[model samples]
Target: MSLPDPPAPIVHPAEYAFGDQVASAEEHLVGQVDQLLRTRFGKPVEAHLAAPTATDFAALRRWYGERAKGWQPLPDVEGAAKAGRGQGFGFSHGDQAFVMVWLTRDAAEGANPVTILRYGKAG
Candidate 1:
């Protein structure tokens, strides 16, 4: 006899922002990221925990900095950069556009610790 099929994983909505708050569970965050990638590039892109260099970090900083005022306070670019170290993902869809994501862990008790460092797009 075959075992029962496993239950589907639960995916919670993620709030993309820059801060020390727990954005969502790791699994949820991964799902959101994958969905975004698939929507933009027609395929899922995995995020890497590799640290970003100063230059690489700066590019993301600049991109987010330019549009920060319109959204939220110029997110702690330096902090995000530091947190993003070894925890960021970058993807491109030809010349159409590109997306970068940086994540930070929340230290709160029972917190998901998968907050988004930054989520921005560039062309």
Candidate 2:
């Protein structure tokens, strides 16, 4: 069977002032997630861009939760660079670390599409 398509990279909301600052961090996160998806499912991770509506949010949550089963939320990201001004949540699968960055309180809402931002074997 083929793998499910991954979520697309999130588009920075208009409120963000300095998105370039986080470009590296964003790439790092994406890479990590892609690696995790490839390793776990034996296929390249595909990202699907979607609006943060109830249906989309639910689908995103279900997808991430299913993929992240047996994975625990990491308390902190070792060597994880501090985001200048963005807000997000982090989780872990064993030593692997994952992070989701966003500005809104409800990252599930507004324009947050790439909810599962990053995943990697934490250092």
What candidate 1 gets wrong by more than 4 Å, as runs, is 1-24, 50-59, 63-97, 106-123
**Best model per lDDT:** 2
Candidate 2 C-alpha lDDT tens digits along 47-123: 32333433344354456557766676543322232332333344555535455533222444344334334333331
Pick out the ten consecutive residues of candidate 2 with the lowest summed lDDT.
77-86
The lowest-lDDT stretch of 10 consecutive residues in candidate 1 is 1-10
Q: Local distance difference test, per candidate?
A: 0.34, 0.41
Please give the RMSD of candidate 2 to the true structure.
8.6
Cα lDDT of candidate 2 equals: 0.41
Most TM-score-accurate candidate: 2
lDDT of 1 by residue, 1-123 (tens): 111111112122254333333334344455544454454345432332322222244454455445433333322323333443423333232422233444443333222222232232322
